[model samples]
Target: MLQLAWGLCLTALLGWDSAVLAAKFRRPAAVFPLPLLCAAALLVYAGALPGFLRAGVWGGVGALGALAVWGALRLGRESVRQLTESSGLMLFLGGAALLWVVLFCLQPMFFQWDEFTAWGLAPKMVVQNGCLYPAQPGNLKASFTYPATSMVTVLFQPFARWSEWGCMAALDTLAMACLAAAAALPNKRRMAGIAVFAAGFVLPYFFADTPAGSYAAQYANAMADLPLFLLFGGSLCLYYALGGQGRAYWLTVLPLMLLTLTKDICFAYGLMAVFLIGLDLWWAGDAPARKRFLPAVAKALPLAVAVVAAFVSWGRYTAAVTPLQETAASVGSEGLSYGAVLLGGVRQLLGIGREEKFAVLMSLMFRAFFTRRVCLLGGGAAAVGCITLAAAAAGCGAETGAARRRVVTAYLGLAFCFAALYLFHLILYYYNFGESEALALKGYDRYLTPYYQAWMLVMLALLGQGAGSRRGAGALCAVSLAVLGIFAGRGVPAAGFWSDASSRYTLRQDVQTKAAALNPALQPDDRVLVISQGDDATRWYYYRYELTGTVADGFSGRYTEVGDTSQREKGDFMNLVSPDNEYLYAGDCTVCTPETLMAYMQETGCDYLLLDRSDGYLQQAFSPYFAGGLQDSMPATLYRFAGCDAAVPFTVAAQESGVAG
Candidate 1:
């Protein structure tokens, strides 16, 4: 926890000094987010370059820190002024939010599926090995192609030890930074900024079906969704507030770069941001229409180049380090690559021969627009449009017309981008997932909610701009607080929120404890097969990550379905054996028998078998093969295949022994 505090302070200093240097020591009106964006961008590069070079990531971090220190020294008193200029309300709210995050993150466990597989795994690999996932030994099942931007965010500890709480805290800090950026609009009405900030803070709860139980649950895990959307939306807010002035170009480009580095799909959001910047520029200035076109293009050119560069560079890097089989473009069983599948999906979208899957996708997407929780784009746009028009009708000012036009333009632009992104996902899923999973539109909200969240922030920023006077702004602030209070009270329970968050990962914690106890008996070089009956295949990943020594080679459950016994041949199940296999369902077949099980152990070079949960089949059919009659422990059992012959029977022991080994 002390490590987390030090890391947070170091990151804050680096971010602030870097932003100050970038701004040439001159304070901007919307000062809070520039540092946040700068820090995120700096961390992305600092974390990434080390992986590409196979060097210590902390060395790169140290270099960045030194540079920030130099910049701060040069700025002198200006740095102190920059800190003093930040909004007190924004700071207080952000601090309060960070405190809540720290408490929630103190659980020290990863609850989400993606956390163990990709998001959490990637970072753990980096911190443990001081390099990328490719450099890690054993069969690492994480998506190696996935960018490490989010991974670096949580690397606060100096030692190689991984901390789940630290990861959550670091990421939640980034999220809060984004909210602060969005709220720090360049408006004279301080109350208006407060209102916008307050709204943006509680916006996640507005969604009916959040992935987690409570609002705090959203930030308690180390997933890329929350940070990606917040950064995307915050970039737009900073651009609008700063007006894309002299040093503001760097601010704009840095956040977009961070956005691009966040996830593969987020590159589109960065591109959309670039286009919107150009559009805003085109709408600004009273120059002739013909002259405005080239100038707008010229101004947006740097952002476009930066985004493209980030995207292409990361793509090339991942391609170089990652195997062809591990990539998203890997060929499937149908003799078509994922790229080919995407092209086919595009053809279906263009009115070529369509399938039932395509129809299902279209129906879900169309229906998503009407769904209250999903259609944040439409809902936010409506609210912004209505507010702008109402202000204009009441004779607020001529500024309302420009604000209205900007709102409409942004709405149409984002709506189109959203549709394109949805289509891309629909097609991508069609190829990557099973028919049922694809048709169900799994992770629909998780994927699309980022865009809506970002859109809402932008709408709030625009709304803040159109707020006429201090009186009206004060009223808006009061109303926003009232709404926020009501929603927060209903959405997050005071008594249960912390306890529920802390207790959410009790099962995972139990797994870790058992793994720690069992790890001493296992050798680092040994290939171990784990059997956890009636559990999800994903549990194998949990064991694989938790075990300090030996590799968790494969997993099999007693209740797994084995289709068509007649068609299966002797030793046919051996074909499924691989280091990469997440779960190998060795059903109640020939493989479960003593002789066949011995053969499997011999063939796979596995000398040890761990029964995480023992069942009837193990005791009756396979017990004699155990070298010492089931080396039992609390809640788990181990079997040694070294001494026992397949045909020999050994003494059986009680399964309920309270032994450690």
Candidate 2:
């Protein structure tokens, strides 16, 4: 709770700084997005400072404090008065924040695969070590080049103990801030704002009917996907709401920089935003083409530069800190270089002859856009209807009609951008992934969902923006409520989503509990080998995360060549194993007999063995090696191996009891 409070307080301070800074240049269209803007600024600071100084977390805190002090001095009585007058926006944000707090309390654990491997792990490392993951002395489990924006944003304070819930709450706060910016729209109608917020909030749930089920689940996890899309969509919505004026270039630059730094692939989104911004600028006035071109270039130049600078700086930093081979290994597969695979994919596209993979990808993407992604399709349809009604009501001569037309143009622009982004992913996967995975389009929805969600939010913003009349606002509200009802019926209920024990959340909770129990008996530098029968690499990742301070390694007990000659006939079956698995063989494999197991332990330098689940074969084969047999424990049994001989049961028990005591 203290961590959560600190996070919220820091978020408020940074948000105030952002608002005050923007107010110095031009009055913001609305103040609700200040937190998100500040978050972007924080990312820029965190990403940049590390290059020049190794001050780590203190450097970030110092930046936050400096910004806050500056904002406090600049904050005038008039600014406070303006903030007070915006009571409706304050209440909406407060309510959303409260709900986020409640959601974090209900489930503060990460259940997703990538959460432990990358998103969740990276931030925890930063918080613990006060430096980037690469700066730490260990083999990098997560990709070193993965953007640290999300990780940096979660660092609410320096020297504070890391809390998973706190990090999650911090992330949720950013998302809420982004969505709440919709209230700052020029449309003063209360119903229209509510409709927009409702649509954006429930947009992720719309994919529940598709392969990416349960937005609540996604929300609970600490993956970068949810926050990345929210920032992307929210930034565009705010831009359009502000009428894409020349003065709002700062808004475009900050968010674009932050978005680009959130994920490596997100640079593409930044470029897409730049294209849209340029388009908006071109269509701004009734000036000649020659006159508009220069102005558009001048306005869009800063945004493009910011995105490129951010991407290049982070790339250079990672290259300096990480080995080229490691980065290549993390990104591509089958020993292919990133560039080679990309070029090969392009060549395949150019010289395609009835490409079955291309056909499948197109078909899947079509279904995803038009049919499976009901929320996007429905939201797009509703946006068009609302814009049409607004245009018809206001007539073509009115400013409102022109704005609605621009909205239509923007929607079409976003569709084109989404297509381009999707094509890029398809091409990358075509070369990087295996034939089966590429054909099946594994993780197809996960890859595209963020972009789709972002596009949906933009569409919803347009719908709200065009809700000029009472009747139009009413229709928009009706559509939003209907969509919400469909989400509730088909998706996981928002209220009970966290409490679903049948989900991966429960399994992770169990892993965490077991790790907590075992961590006490183990030393910080202990080398622990985890063995969980019937489990995969994911379980080891959980233990690796939970065991913190200890070196944890493990095998995926799911499959092994063992006594199967047919499987052995397959050349190098180990090549098929996931790189995530620390050890290649299962506990019960033919090569895992007593003497071989001891040799394996020595080879890996593992001093402790944790049987997360033991089979009959494991018990019979290894029990004789332990002098006092396996130390029985809930969820797992611990075996302490000291120089190829098991330690006495009593000594281990005493240490465990002492730690528990």
Task: Evaluate model 1: give its lDDT.
Answer: 0.59
Q: Could you give candidate 2's per-residue lDDT for residues 1-661 as a string of tens digits?
A: 6665666666565545545544564544243354444544455356534642235345555666786677667765544544444432453456446755665566456777677767887777666655667655543433543544445444553554777666676666667666766555442455666666766677767643343343355556678877788878877876766666645546656666777878767778888888887887776455665788888888888789988997877666666777765554333556766676566666666765536776676666555544433343343344334334433432222236456556656767877886678678877666667877876667766777777677667766666666666655655666567657767666545433345434546778787777776776776467776666556566777877787445554322332323332322211111122223447544432233455445555766877776677555555545566545542232465566665543432123222223422
Q: Would you list the C-alpha lDDT of every candidate in the order shown?
A: 0.59, 0.59
How many collisions per candidate? Answer: 0, 0
Model 1 scores worst on lDDT over the 10 consecutive residues at: 571-580
Worst 10 residues of 2 by lDDT: 570-579
TM-score of each: 0.81, 0.80
